[model samples]
Target: MKKFWNWKNQAQTENSPAERTLFLNGTIAEESWFDDDVTPQLFKDELNAGEGDITVWINSPGGDCVAAAQIYNMLSNYKGKVTVKIDGIAASAASVIAMAGKEVLMSPVSMLMIHNPMTIAMGDHAEMQKAIDMLAEVKESIINAYVLKTGLSRAKLSHLMDSETWMNANKAVELGFADGTLTRDNGGAENSNMEDAVEAVMFSSRAVNNALQNKISAKYGKQKQTVVQQSEIPAPETNERNVDALLERLDIIKNHI
Candidate 1:
């Protein structure tokens, strides 16, 4: 009898002791769209793999509201602790995902933008009115997420969402959008150069103004002058130095005659 090997079971058995952390990046679209294929599988695998804290880093511009809501719920309900780090920007649906984190962090330069949910539809007036009503309900769902995360009043949260609020890392911390600031350098040299360039421009502008003022003062101080001279008339005489001069005088006399 030959021994049979089970690779799938063997690998799972070996890896079960180690904790796994999955990374989710990019836009969140509709459940029937691209997100369904990627997010659900990843979530299922990560959830089943091991019992460990999951840290999710988000820098998305946001997409389908429904997909974002689903992903948010999944993370929020996960048994293990979830931490979210916003390394760059988290806008629209991305912001909703951030709310799922038990502890949220944001880099100094990272930003968050939130707004009312929206969609386009073409139909009769009644159908259009229904679409408007649907959008209002979706907006409420989004507002609920923010209210849950921030613990702010629903009315206040709804107002901010309606206006499409933008929050920096510090503002995010203050408003409870982010729990705290993360210590991550986004490369300091570029920022230093930008500051230096601004200073140089300001100094150059001052130098130009000083030069213009000096020129204006100098123009007022300087006196204009006009000089003229009349020379005494000298008697006309023929040149006796060379034969060429004599020939030239003879040609002039001939022409005059």
Candidate 2:
């Protein structure tokens, strides 16, 4: 709720004209606690306050996907230039919001993370399948944003999301997720309270195959090793008698010689 976002002018001095800059901290939510008053509409209202370029500073562990999607769309639709600066960390849903910026800048030490949308469901077999289908569609939607922003192939973006990829400023720029790294000197455009935005959050990144295998093992127990038994067959009786007869004839021939 209150910890969601902070909107402020980027420039503080009277000599410098007011510049619209939004500092997005903590988690992104569909609505603030209680009602829908503190969501995308509120953000748009704040954005309407000033003219010129809009700069957004994000440092969040990320939250609701729907909210992030709405904010992303709004920023993408904005007429003025939208600049996003990541001062701490933007992961998961926050990463999607980051893509809306016309120019994305990351602090040298900041991080960006992208991962598949996760959800919990309670259902029968058919309902489980439906959940799977819905997740597939959601994953596709997320992939679209990443593909448009990075110009990376959908397959590559999918693979990256599968692994819950994490990127630093330079790496983010290299991957085209960010335009450049921010270099702050004498408190220019950097967040004044950057330390307050820091968060320790881990991505749910255990290898899916490995996890499935472990679950299967736990359910069905490890497969038992098969043992092959060898058996010896005696020579055929007819063949043995024929060999004896041949040896007897050879002995008689030798005796006659």
Candidate 3:
């Protein structure tokens, strides 16, 4: 079975602290956790082998929510401080694991995404309902993790998940998904030119959507006010309603990407 995590021990230096580092890269738990018992045992053994602070470097698209949940629990209960550093993208189930961190930091160009839990089910109406109920419970459990880390209300977090929110580093920090952005002064020297190039490409899609939203709002704001004043019509209710609907549609479009 392919391991999802890699471990390394860094010796203490004159200027830096000694800590174990774990890399969680690529798709998490590409193999099902329930397939065999060895994987979890090996992961737990490696995690418990050392003492002192540990830093987890995450760059995953996310997979296998059950595996992520087990990892999160282990890290949360560990004796040493757990620091999570997102160096690329942490989305879906990976975002749940990130909440186990005592301090979560994202690279300036890193991305984090959260969405409602999903599953495949094929059966009669009763089975379909059971699947839906299961997913709802799973999403609630995931929200519990987010609530603990971000202090965001369950309703707000649920809405974000419903919309499949994607956040950049600054936004992540603002929303409490991350403590802060990593920087050279903060011992983050791993970000290189190549990573920046990749970030540029990945971030462009979101940038365009944001720009479009702003442009539409700005152009319509003035027009809406002008129409109301010229016609003496009670346009606020209608215009506001339509604007909200339009923005919701835009969000739906953006989320699909």
Model 2, position 96, has a per-residue lDDT of 96
> Tens-digit lDDT track for model 1 on 194-220?
222222110123445657866754554
Residues 1-257 of candidate 3 have per-residue lDDT tens digits of 78879988745567665679999999988976856578888899888877789999999999988888999999999998999999999999999999999999888878999988988999999999999999999999999999999999999999888767888887787788888777674654532323333332223344567688788877887777788899997854433444546788878999996
- Write candidate 2's Cα lDDT for 29-148 as tens digits: 735633465556777777665666888999999888877888889889888899999999999999999999998988877899998998888989999889899889988999899989
Predictions ranked by lDDT, top down?
A: 3, 2, 1
Clashes of 1: 0
Give each prediction's root-mean-square deviation over alpha carbons. Answer: 23.4, 17.9, 9.0
- Residue 211 of model 1, lDDT score: 77
The per-candidate count of clashes, in order, stands at 0, 0, 0
> Which candidate comes out best when scored by TM-score?
3
**Candidate 1 Cα lDDT to native:** 0.67
TM per prediction:
0.62, 0.69, 0.72
In model 3, what is the error at residue 247, expressed in angstroms?
Answer: 17
